[model samples]
Target chain A: MKRFATKLLTAVLLAMFLFVGTQGFAQTINIALANNPISQALNKLAKEKYKAAGVTVNIAVLPENDLRQKLTTEASTGGTSYDMFFIGPYEAASWAKNGWLENLEPYFKAMPAAKLTAYDRPDLIQGMVGSLAVKGQSYALPFYGESSFIMYNKELFAAKGLTMPAEPTWDQIYDLAKKINDPAKGIVGMTMRGAPGWGMSGAPFVTIVNAFGGKFYDMKWNATVDTPEQRAAWAMYKKVLRDAGQPDILSYTYNECIALMQSGKAGIYYDATSIAPALEGAGSKVQGKVGYAMAPHQKMMTNTSWLWNWAMGINPKSSDAKKKATFDFMVWATSKEYAKMSVDLDPTGSSTPPAARTSTYALPAYSKTPYAAMTVKALKAMDFTKPTIDPVPYVGLQYIAIPEFADAGTQMTQFLADYVVDKITLDEAIKKTNDVFNQVAVDGGYRK
Target chain B: MKKKNDWPFILPAIFVVAVMTQVPFLLTVVYSTLRWNLARPDMPIVFSGIDNYLFFLKIPDFTVVPEFYSIVLQTIIVTVVALVICTVIGFLFSILLDHPIPGVNIARTLIMGPFFVMSTVTGVIWKTTILNTTFGWYGVLAKSIGLAPVDLLSYYPLPVIIFLFCWQWIPFFVLIILAGLQGISGELVDSMRIDGLNWWQSTFRVKLPLIMNHIRVAVMLGLVFIVKEFGLILVTTAGGPGTRSYTLPYQVYMQIFSASNVGRAGALATMTVVLTLLAVNFVSKSMKKNNL
Candidate 1:
């Protein structure tokens, strides 16, 4: 028994020694990122450079919903499983307020003078910076920023004898869609995301609701989804999709819209402006045949577009050493050097991250791209602080700015989808959704 | 007497099982009694008694039923419908394939292909390649016939999902039932034929009784698995068209991951387990009664 006890003690001590020895040799950080085109490119571009920095990176690329769930679980549990993660404005602001994210402002101030100069913290887009900040404390670094816009096939418009206005109204766009729709030729007049999720159909749909002067809530947290203005927005959304949208409109997401535009099957596409590069670059059948326009409006004219970004944030639960290593990697990944590397790596210029930095737009190569100016213009034209014409309890252009909004808003989209598909009456959809949302608000102690 | 000393050998497994299942379950029951919303970091997590359970149980209006009941009903309907179709069609297919024919093994293997495919893959194939109104074969075929194809995934999501579940699971039923059919003695078959028993009588009266045990086992396994299916629903309908096809497990997932209400999720999970156990017990009892 004494021999066995000694042997077990020695084995445990040896295991501890090996663990400490390996951890001391080099720092390793785990980063959770959403699986998107730009992040895929980043994963490929940062391979050798991350290893060369004397730190190993373990990245988990998951679908957008899965990424959000995993990162939220880790942070809420105060687990140190992830050292860094990719987050959007919704998560950045909420997590920072929860005291879950490492304040990157202090990290920025602590950088060596010369290194800070090279990092050019000021050159990062202020709009993105402000969105990811809470009470003037920065929570994340913008990797890429985007706003919404309209991308139309100029050839289709010309053939139909219709010219798109630079800033069109929703009514005008609907009329044009009616004119341009040609199902016989397998062409639809417009394409938008219709998949049921908060980020899927809800993004574009919320902006439409904003343009139509509808708010999800009143100043005192009363649900206003069944209001006249909101009903009008829903009617318009349903009318266009039913008349001129894809045959499988309910199944279409942004990827499908992109593919439809590239195939020249869509007359108009309204989605993220960042996808313009993909529509105009090599391998696109509609290259040079697409035209850009601002997001459409009906009542509220200004700030009709959305502001969105996927930023990098540090986990507050990480040890100081891992946090430092993670901050360094975040710096490198968002640096000008990485931007140039990405641009050079992608010949088509479609997959390179963009709109995060002022200097990126100043690059001679990027400015020459036809859609770069429009992308920047759209990004600056929206404000998330004031989303609707009427006073509301939330702040977000394309989403509601509460942690509970992701759940409630997604539940609301199911009713919208059913309404869009004529599965339920408009009144029934409205009553069910409002009930669900109001119940969530009351349960979460958000409403009085 | 040396056998009494064997506890040391069994204690590790008991410990592992306790840690893996019972401990977590106990924690879940404790959590279900609290008011914990992970999303609302501002709210204090405190003991709230049975408030979480009551939240799901309370229905404000009979006309407007709560989602929990609807989800449970949908789960039952989907499981029961899918099992019936799979068993009926699978038994017929097994009877046909049980005949002596060349390349019978090939046919059986081909039928088993979908059962081997991942559920997510099956959903993707059905959604994108078959049911998609614009990009799929259904669209082309419908258009060729001069008729517009309605979006089956959105309009008739429940039926489409039930059909796909049957397509994928029927093969598993066939495998087991066919084994039972092949096990019947050749003397019995010769005796049935000599007694002028028709094919229908032999099949429905004799063969089915012999295979009730196999069918019961298949239904039990199917119920256990299909009730917990998440990926297929996610990849295809996503529990949408106003949660018309949502199951209890899907609701638990939404409560935990989407709502970030750990307490509520625990409540939903406990109810789901209870409902599942009740279903399994009822099935086992009914099957035993039928056997008797």
Candidate 2:
């Protein structure tokens, strides 16, 4: 009986130790992310670096639309499946307004001064910080900030005897594209997103509209989609895409455009500045031959480039402990320390996160990199406070920061796509685009 | 006048069915009567009394791309075209498979292959591998032949979607019609042949008449399934080149998930249920009249 009792006690003790050890060793936090290069890089670092720091990070990377839908569904029900998620500026305000995002200001304040200084809150890009905040309260921390710009092949320009200005106009870009286009040689001169969704065509197209002096809505919220500026922008976009764009451009999104540029097939790619890392990465064919320029201008009353940031927002429904863990991971992942560590891991600066912080950008190694320098210049030039030439009742450049705008923007993209392919006439496309905007305006109570 | 105690045995099944099917439907009906926007929590939910329904049904100006009526018409047209193509092709394939040709088993497997593929995979394969303008097989073939590759999805979005649906579901119809063909005895076919009927006459007058019930079943099943075809359309073209291919189900999905207008989505769902019920009822009545 004594021996049996001792054996039982030993078994119970072992079980308790195992349970406590597991609990202490592996506290997991789930992160929902969009499947972008930045997110993938973060996931790699989390596994390699943060796993040893006592928290197991589980990341679910989904496509952009799928991630949006999943986060929206979870937010609607106040679900706790995800402890944190990546959100765009367009969704930050709406999600914050809906009480789905945790206010990150308090968390930042609660951190020790030493830690705060290390994180360097003020070092963050002002435009990015402003865009990720709602009513002056930060709700998310930007993982990487991006603005639109034109990336071209310097070698291609030299071969074709073409001169691209540092700040080229849309007409100039179009002419360059036509000159360099060699369909017989299987090279596309220009590549842009033509996929049907709003995030695909609508993103770049909105910047075009802004550069042409088109407004989504007037101060009174009347849809201005039928304006002469919008028509001109659409006409230019359609003609250029048809004449110089890659074949089956309708299926091309950002990834496809990047692939075309990297494979030395495209002469010029006008897209997000964040693609710099991929374009200059080790595997890139045009790494040494790529050139950066400002986004093309038309009227140039306002900058044509858009302001976008992929930021991490904590779920409001998470427990305080989970929130703390999430914030810790977020700060660490976005900190200068993390950026330095990333650069050390890959000395070529390809793995370095887009410098959200001024200090990170000031790093001697990062500042000297061509892509990094160009990206910082573009980021500094963006004015999120006034993204368009005309005053509109929204705060977004690529997208209007309203929930209704998601639907309206997607519908308008469909119309623009059809118009580009000659599936519908320009007039019909404009009418349909205006109708969608008007309906959204009235239904959202922005107009009567 | 008999009081059957079978209720006791079936009560659990009835309860399960009610819980599985009726509760969400009832919730949807309740939700349809309220004004609920998930994005606008400041706007309190209140009784709106068919406002959402009316809003959805309201006709836009003809200039608009997706007038509500146009979506409905397009949905119907796609469903009909898909059904006709699936039924005819499936029946012919079923007849072909019944023959004792060499390598017939392998051919049968190949014919049944698409049915096992998921809808999303079907859409992706068609969009990326088959129909893509640049890198797809169609483009490669077109280019190799020294012709400009056609952007089939952009130019003919609806027809291409219909083709995808038909491709995926035809195998299902084939299996059904093939099973129905097996039920007709060899003796009956022999008698029809001995009765001086030509091959075409026997097929039209005897075999087709016999399998009319199977054809009806296939059509009804296709109608029921095609109305909920969201994945294929969502993955390819996204109901576009301008709402030329937008269906009612895709519209409802956009209203709920994309637009966050749950009340409007609910209203659309209620209408879809009603229409589907009416269609099922009509199909059943026709089957009864034919004594199948």
Candidate 3:
């Protein structure tokens, strides 16, 4: 019995080795996606399509921060764990310069059909792709682009006899919020993200600062946030968020704001345009009584609505064969036909690709949706020319450029959080943010 | 002749230990001293020496201190608080369960349910369901009681996290101490009773003395758990409300992943390791003295 058992174990080991060897030759694409509704739909579509193509696609859906952490770790370590990743323009330029991403210029050129040729790349509304590309090589493909807008409760506005314009000023928005705010009835005048992080609080703050004509960095990479424009913007934002926002606004992210607006607690939600579809869904309590308008501005009409959300990128560490497979999969998955298939499967219209393709937006399917016309108008009306009212060198709409921006930005964010929590003064926070980053710049061999 | 085969006995163990601990530890030490940004791995990893360490120390956010000192303070706070709370609660419950009661085992097992939960899940459940200021169940209850809802996160983050840590770990210590309690020969209690010793006196002089070693072991284990706790902090506060609850592991995470300051992050990790070693040594020395 012992001899037979030993023989059986040997046979099993040999068979496993052979199976692994065969499987090694088989092409498998490892795709990492953000844990968003649209990405979930895309994963479901990729599984079916990749299976038909005699390839296996392993998908890992992670939250925004985890996805960033994992992808950054993998890319930096030159690990080939992910063949394709859903990234954003935030790290695209820096990652591309670091040679962590495969330049998709050649691939896109080879497959002209996959490229947005006749779709007018310049008029795509969000010109983040231009910012993401270095010299002439496109590093990451744009899956979706977004800008901020004001989503308000129409019924509450009507009840309060408030009149909000198609494009209102900051003062008007503040007055409207003050009028509609009824805390006794469990309604807040306004709700925006006040969570202390670059992505959470800083994104909207940057836009407001831009509208008020703030500049983060000067011509020579010196810290320039102590300007009058920035101080005014920061002061105003703190006042509004503190008063009209939920008591727990300090912890609010995009999802929290969405919940606030959808549940009839918020009179106005200033956030991403992508939330319009979600807000207009059948499950939403305040669906039909919602209105969309441009992001409120101050002295200038310019407000930077960033091209945010996940985009596909190829891994630089992958083998040539793996790269080809990844590129092919990206093209196939992001193709117009595939998007249509995704929409068909998930008819909520949440699965449709948020692209700049005029042709795709002009589709009868997209046009039939209530959000289609407004979404198109919002996309078309976005101004990339003047991202900031004040002069600055970088092109990022919602963030500062430079590799050290993450660290410096986080330090600044913590300072702001402290100030808001009354741990420090706003003037003290400003001085600290500017001085710390300026010293860091000097230390990193840059003139400040 | 028998000693010649000792190499064979130790080879596999050595290999496993190296793979699991030594290699990664060595890498962390190397990365901590070098200007190695993972996003730009191709760039020649420059040797910045103690500059990264100094820079992290001087990081002008809230406080100015060496990364080593900051991590040591945080590690002590988390471990010490968790150790005291877990030991007190665990010992109390273990005595309760030592008696003959109907459904006692069921009650004990239900209390241990938190030990079965993933740390991340624990953080998420607490943050969203129980501790959420506005819409959470806890908030709803608070509002129903005609009280202004409390943002448990804003004012009381560290204490709530400590409570969570204690809630999860107390059951494990209970299980350990219960086993120790059961092994304390009944004859000792009988002898105490014959001597006319009260329950409190017997527990203090007899039962407690016997379980000192077990208690030490539980404290040591709890120390290790608290030292490595990052998931809860990361998920719940992300080390927030202005860095009040930032622990050693969470600091390392913020430095490495969040700030992408890998060199400084490495310095933080090295400091953490040194502190963990010192803590373990201290615990073991105390345990040896107690045993003596």
Chain A TM-scores of each predicted structure, in the order given, are 0.91, 0.93, 0.88
Q: Note the residue pairs that clash in candidate 1.
A: none
**CAPRI quality level assigned to candidate 3 from its DockQ score:** acceptable
**Between candidates 2 and 3, the DockQ winner:** 2
Once superposed on the true structure, which residue ranges of model 1 sit more than 4 Å away at CA? A1-28, A48-51, A319-321, B1-13, B194-196
Model 2 chain B: weakest 10-residue lDDT segment is B58-67
Local accuracy of candidate 1 as per-residue lDDT tens digits, A17-56? 9989887878779987776667877787777555545588
Residues B170-233, candidate 3, lDDT per residue (tens digit)?
Answer: 8889989888898888898789889999989888778988998788888888888878988888
lDDT tens readout by residue for model 2, B179-272 = 8887889999889878989978987778888988888888889889988889999888788777788898998898898878889999999998
In candidate 3, stretches whose alpha carbon ends up further than 4 angstroms from where it belongs are A1-26, A47-51, A109-128, A342-348, A368-374, A380-386, B1-19, B40-44, B58-72, B283-292
User: Which candidate order results from sorting by TM-score in descending order?
Assistant: 2, 1, 3
Please report, in order, the local distance difference test score of every candidate based on alpha carbons.
0.87, 0.84, 0.76
Better of 2 and 3 by lDDT: 2
Interface RMSD of each: 1.3, 1.4, 2.2
List model 3 lDDT by residue over A328-403, tens digit each. Answer: 7776665667656756765656677665344556666666666666666666666554577667766666677666
Candidate order, lDDT descending: 1, 2, 3
Residue lDDT tens for model 2, A1-448:
9999999999999999999988875557899887777777788888888843557788888878778877887887788999997888888888888888999989988999999987888888777888778789999998888898999998989998887898888989899999989998888889999886667788899889888888888988888888899999999888788999988877787878888898998999989888877888778899878899999889854467988888999998988778888999999888989888877776656777684777777777777777877787788787776767777887777888788777788888888888988878999888878877887787777775
How far out, in Å, is residue B46 in model 1?
A: 2.2
lDDT of 2 at A66: 75
